[model samples]
Target: MHSINIHNKSGHDQTFEVHGWANNQNITVKAGQTSKIPAPDGSSGAIIALHEGHEGEQVEITKNGYGGNDFFDVSNIVGAGGNITAMQVGDQSTLKGDPHFMQDMNAAWHKASQDTRNKLKGFVFTNGQGKVTRIGPIKDSPELEKLVRTFANGKAYVGVGAWNGNPGNPDDNAQSSAGHGNKDILITYNDGDASPDLASPKRESRVAAFEVQRVQVAAAPPAPPANGPGIILTNKSKQECTYFFYGNYWNGNGTAGANFDKPMKNVTLAAGAKSHIPLPTTFKGRVQRGTELPATWVEFQISASNDGAAHGDISLEQGCDGAATIASTDGTNRKNGFANDVLKDAPAAACAKKPNGTKAIATTVGNWAAGPNQAAIDYLKKVVGQKKAYIVGGTGTDDVASKNKCLAVDMY
Candidate 1:
């Protein structure tokens, strides 16, 4: 009568033996159900679930949901169950095993569930001159035949509008060409019928059949680039960026020398530029932008490292505006697919902890991982007017031969 404190998470009506309460022998909590027990004198009790094979799940109950939990609703509670009742299940840990508390994690779940469950089944209809005609099948029906005749070129543009099922579809639009397995409605039209009197009923199947006997074609993977497997990095950023790639191949523990630790690799990228890098499947690295420490970077891996799914994480370890992306095709399938990116559909803080070492990457084949090709000017001004004077290098780029083009990253 006060608030629903005891809940039955079982599959049937569970009678719980009430203890430490007056004039109450048993409390029946329906399967996946909850109930309120009014304690006029303000009493407390424990309810032992009388469920088959589950007699051990005992729950404690109180007038006000105890232990700082608000199974009790104030002004802050929201939807479905709230509209059904006014109670709220704020912190469920207090009433941990209460079936009804936070039963629907999302408040709109109940209404959304009911709507999905009560969806209309498959129905067919014809619309001609602002009128919806036929309700069922089309064969031998004069109404549909007449509807088709009204349209121009004796051709009716069949737009299969509404298709509904329990969860299978309403997810995807009804496709133009039929036979995709979900729900297909193909409209066949003819000026004449297959009556017993006619020598032959003209049932013309639409679209070109075999245009094959004419010349057949089979589906194949996309054509690979003239160069071996590799990734194409495009610089779409307005500002010039210096990009770097360092492999994960570990050496002892040095930075620049032939010892270990120090790693570096980078190329200049003008505002709008593109570069393709041919790498090995054994290549594991980091692709980043900027010249100094703490620049924009993302962990990029687009090739099959596991011989299956290639994964790339948006390592916000260093930050990016989130537009950087690494996309590539499969070596085995030769199909263009799999794009790993930052910011676009990914959240900033979502991808935490990511890599790339310093300029030692040149001597180091791979340290962090890999970026693009564009002549981005170094931040250091080389003109004679400034204080720290240094001679400008003629051009910057190194040729590194790699086997098996395994990755590509796009930094925008």
Candidate 2:
């Protein structure tokens, strides 16, 4: 005996017991309800149920509240310990029309019955306007027909294969060597001698003569930068366009690399138009000398306007300071030198270098180990200090030195 369980969205569970041969049995559940059907033990049968249809082959079990219904087959559920689950079908009305229909057809082809396939044969595809411009059977359609002809005739044919003098077997030569010296020219001949009055003309088939065309489109321009001294604007359109620039600045700590508080504005430009505006050279406050300013990169940005006009924004990193000939190409390499002067004065220009004779400033303040004995010294210092702390070490002979230092510092 096998058991089938059906669950509905209304929290109702229905179990059906199958003793044998259950075919096309219809089980109806309420709208907005989920159903579950389990396979019968030691029994093989097929069952049919109404479900909800969606964009793809997926079907949902729903009560009457939903719009459409679908049919599902469960013939292969015999001797299975698991139960088949069912749920209320959801709505798919928001999908775009063109691609969505195509996708639906593709899914239907995979899950369709023989009757469905035959019915689809009569259905025609059309553009969004709903005009039936395409014709022919699905398998023998112009698109697939062309591909088939190319595969049949080595040299590519429109409709049928050309005779290469290999007659005995339509696919092979009569005397294998008989057509060795035949010319490699495309020739079309009568399929048979039934119409002997007219000589067959040699020509490429219609299927083989079609050509595919591909067109290239231009891409849109990039967005303008966001942080710099001057207002930078960009046109988003593909054609030559102009944009307006308004005054803009970071509201917070005018640190050289900090992000601006306000967002930039952008305006559209007509083709062949250009807009120019003056940049702000100096920031509002006298940036203090001693305390380090917020690390900010410099770039340009357009100002926001009340009228809702578009503006461009640009931002640039400050140049390196302190160490002469320093490499500040990326964030990882831009470490602080010995004194605050080196890191503090680093340029706001990205990937920029400092002049020679600049002082070294320590960008990072934590203690780091260099040699094998360094870990030992670090451990000793930590243990000797009055503050509670943790000691971590890597696995290596150098770790012995760290252990010794920890013991000496009473950190062990």
Candidate 3:
């Protein structure tokens, strides 16, 4: 039998059905596709039947594949004895009924595929230390270039060692010197993990770097991670926002208690993007909150259209966008007890029980639904779910104040 291969170089996808030849079935090939089909027994060469209907349309076997609207059936007419055999077909439209004509066409398709596979492809750079430095069209980078130069004189194979699909854009339909843009540059090293752990297994023992040899031109390097020393702040709101994280000083010397407060990490969160804002690591530990001046609490000022701040002490101004009440690691019996109070494990220790030491009683003050802090509360919850959050305040008590020190509490 002969060999017929089909490659879809067009931008769109095409489907074909095989009937009366070798197999009877339909296959949809996306743009830049390739497939092969052999001729059936008792058939000289194969017949290429073509029709004008859209792909995947069910057609009669007579006028579909073997007996389509047009037929290029050349059987038992080629190099060997009269045996009805079909070789292969890349494009049935190019089939010729002549003896060697169809066979030559098949050979040409094979050659074209070979040429594509043989081209010098793209490069993927990885450090000898198992770090992927770069991928895609080759570009210059200090770290990657240095690594390449160091390995070039050593065990790294510089030329065509083997043929494989390019990893970066392996299935890209765009025609390139490499078939389907799938060729790889495998850089081996003399050193690597011989035995890796079960949880974190290694792929190859000595593969230090892997570069995909690409026929396409390289583009610019990708942007690096956002620079700074803080929690990455993301803005999912449509409008921009100016945020200020207030220091833990809710019960101290008026607003001046902000002295212990951090230098505001004011960040503008663009809609649908994230930015970084630093928070002191100290905020993760235990905290205390009571009816003292300048209670130790975490606070943040958020200003979008209006400005408001949420504290770890379950306090927020009228404009406070949102809040969340966190229970102590060990829930308490009293609704306002330090264990069961609004403040548990808070970082601040400034506020302490005074004249009415045990006189304080824990009580549930704010309802999330009726309160204005629900938005901020939901946001913190989402961030935590993403594993991007850490607990801040950890201790507090239920103290009834004529005017609540805070209207809402935001976890961030």
Candidate 4:
């Protein structure tokens, strides 16, 4: 159920062998690489042995902690012991013998079976003065050694979540590893001058030959509205246009001076600029450019298809563009300017200026439209990954929303 993330931050390679109560398998992590080991098959827990250095001769573990306990001891049954100089568990609440972790930790030993009671557990890594504390049982008697040998199973797959490099005795890093249960453990080895507590991110040293960390799993949020495909009506003309936008998804403005019928009323679109108008899911609306026109406006609708794909159609007339509408809060005081064709939803795209569409559709269906900036729209037929398709509307235009270089790019 639990897993360990091994960060091989050392210059040399490292091998993590899964053994003990969980599973048995050897994972070799190349320098600069990160990997994971999981306790397979719904098992409660398992012992992870980290074999580091050329000769692999390190050993330092807390020892047999009881049921559901996070603290434990390590031993070297084989001829392997003491080379790795650093170790950390969780957030280091237990390392440096923090009073908090050290307080109730000794109690977990009492919870173990009687034979395991012979062992004593305490801090395994260096303290503030760089004084490395003693590891293993308090008294190394034959009985305790046999008990440790029984647990070691005649092999040392020793493991610690971190390392401080004992290059002379390369075989020592393999002598000790704390057993892990249901929590994710991260192990990053550091050889350079650094703090013994390797918990914080601010002090991470870049001089590692390699490092490994768990690929964190997080719950995903809802799909963003801007991620949904939509339509963009760009304006390249020199005359500023008053754009009125409304639809079934839009709840009309009821403010004192605001229009009561349409959601977007008396919105201004300057000449030579563009605006981003959002189309909601399962949408059906009529796009009218000017207050009056030579012909009727274009009607379009979109519905959610299987997966994240969508299917939509636009009823194009000869002229939906080239028009600017002028009106008041109510549907009165209507005036019109020269408008252009509106009936074509092809693969054509342009960019005058960039536009960033807010992710509003993720919450509710409402009248959403953005503009007064140079923008463009594209079909986004196939995105290699989640990277948005880059749509350039030529020299005079810009589409910021479609050109997100932060997450890689697919030029169109």
lDDT of 1 by residue, 316-360 (tens): 222233344443343333222123332343332222222233221
RMSD of 2: 30.4
Every model: Cα RMSD to truth:
28.7, 30.4, 28.2, 24.8
TM per prediction: 0.26, 0.15, 0.17, 0.24
Question: Which runs in model 4 stand beyond 4 Å of their true positions?
Answer: 21-23, 40-67, 76-90, 96-182, 188-412
lDDT string for model 4 (1-412, tens) is 5444556555766665554332455666787676766532223232333433322222222212111122222323222212222233454422221111211222333344755543333323234663332234322344434333333321332222122222212222222222232244554433331123346433232111111111111123323344333444444455765554434321111100111134434345676665545555444334444432211232223322222222111111111232222111111221222233221332223111112211100100001111111112222112110111111110121111111101101000
The top-ranked prediction according to lDDT is 1
Cα lDDT over the full model 3: 0.25
Model 3 Cα lDDT, one tens digit per residue, 194-249: 01111122223211211111111112232222332223344433566555554322
TM-score order of candidates, top first: 1, 4, 3, 2
**lDDT of each structure?**
0.30, 0.21, 0.25, 0.29
lDDT of 4 at 187: 47
Provide backbone clash counts, one per model: 25, 70, 63, 59
- The local distance difference test score of model 2 is 0.21
lDDT score, candidate 1, position 58: 36
